[model samples]
Target: MVATTASTGALPPDLFDTTTLVSLAATLVLLGAGYAASRQFLPKDAKNSARVLFVWHAFDALIHLILEASYLYHCFFSWIPASSVTAEDLGSSQFYMPQPSPFLGHADRIYGPQAGAIHGNALAKLWMVYARADHRWAGPDLVVISLELLTVFIAAPMAIWICYDLSMRRSRANVLMLIVATGELYGGFMTFCPEWLVLSENLDCSNFMYKWVYIVFFNTLWVWLPLYAMYVAISEISDAFAVRDALAKVKKSN
Candidate 1:
């Protein structure tokens, strides 16, 4: 069945409703609590901000692997029915059809009009909720999907490892963070710039939640935070090199 529409015939409640706001608020609170808890496990001399950074990376990794991966899985795999008989029963004669199961297909029917329903699964339905909120994501943009797949599968795991290494004061952490941050910065720009250049008609900057929260906050966070992480990585690398250079000079002089 199609997703239920709002009574006013404007949009579904899940599109840009209070649930989105609550989810965002709860996420922020959970991140804050995680940071606070991380601080207790940190070295006594650790900087206050380091705890927050650790938690951020940890959360980033979790989101990439769990949330983004789920989206990606549903994007590709959910199209294939569990059983051939089910596809045949659904009126498809093909053996390997790219269609959602009966239940998700019903959701697709209900919610598909609000946003593009590429797959007929709960995850795809949830994806459409965000899509309806941000017009930029209203369709199944293959470019965006490919980028997300790379980010979720490759970059996210790297971020998780970097977080662990940084917490343990590993020497390679800065270099790894530099790499990940560069990828993030590039990914953020690529995800938006092409669409903007094409004069995207799908962009739905109608209100505060869609314009500011979903589009601005969600996208820019990757840009700004990754930029900052790159800066930190560079500074740390520079400092280490400077220290090594000084030590080498002193040894030569002696």
Candidate 2:
């Protein structure tokens, strides 16, 4: 799949130069839309909390964009700015060269079979393949990275919001909650399924904690949190609908 390939293989090197700015703009626009939607539909009293959540998502998206942009820059520039690099910089660097992780101690923080199934694992493979095959990881790598991050940071949130709204108006917060929770649980499972393959198929992981505990646990959060949020939204919408019905009955009686 294209997801398993690196941008170094297809895209031109110049793309990463403005990646940060482009992502920042896109994130801002999305956040703005969320804020506007809340203002249009939500009661004034409810706007604050919703707005806060929106802000959080906006920030998170920006962070995600930054992370990927940084990765792309590193892939092209062969060096990252010291201030922006995370602890995983080492892993990222090795991944750039398509090297298996040297930080087995941190593998739990990063590797897995589920990752291999997701565009994320495919993305890593693309880089690895490019590095190993004497080919550049470029266009395909960009698509893979963008697709994976978009689902986690953007599409997931929107899905949750939709589910939440539907539940709330229908007085089905409980159902919404279940949906959010289950989706997250499922998403996490999906995320990890590929890692088992990555490990067993190639004997890639050298550290248990880094691969299983850290990577599995933390990445699962993205799937879970959004699902939960959608559940809350559904419950709220359900309440709104009930109130509307009660008022309609009162009008009919009068």
lDDT of each: 0.59, 0.42
Top model number, TM-score: 1
List, residue by residue over 129-231, the lDDT tens digit for candidate 2.
2222212232123333444454456545554454345324433434444554555456545544554455423222223322333233435446656664665
Top candidate (lDDT): 1
The C-alpha stretches of model 1 lying farther than 4 A from their native spots are: 1-22, 29-37, 80-125, 136-139
Q: What TM-score would each prediction reach against the true structure?
A: 0.73, 0.39
In candidate 1, what are the lDDT values of residues 42-158, reduced to their tens digit?
A: 566765445555676776776677556766665544443243234353331112112333434443421221122333344444454566444333333556677887899889889
CA error at residue 187 for candidate 2, angstroms: 6.8
- Report the lDDT of model 1 for residue 40: 56
Enumerate clash totals for all models, in the order shown: 5, 51
Worst 10 residues of 1 by lDDT: 92-101
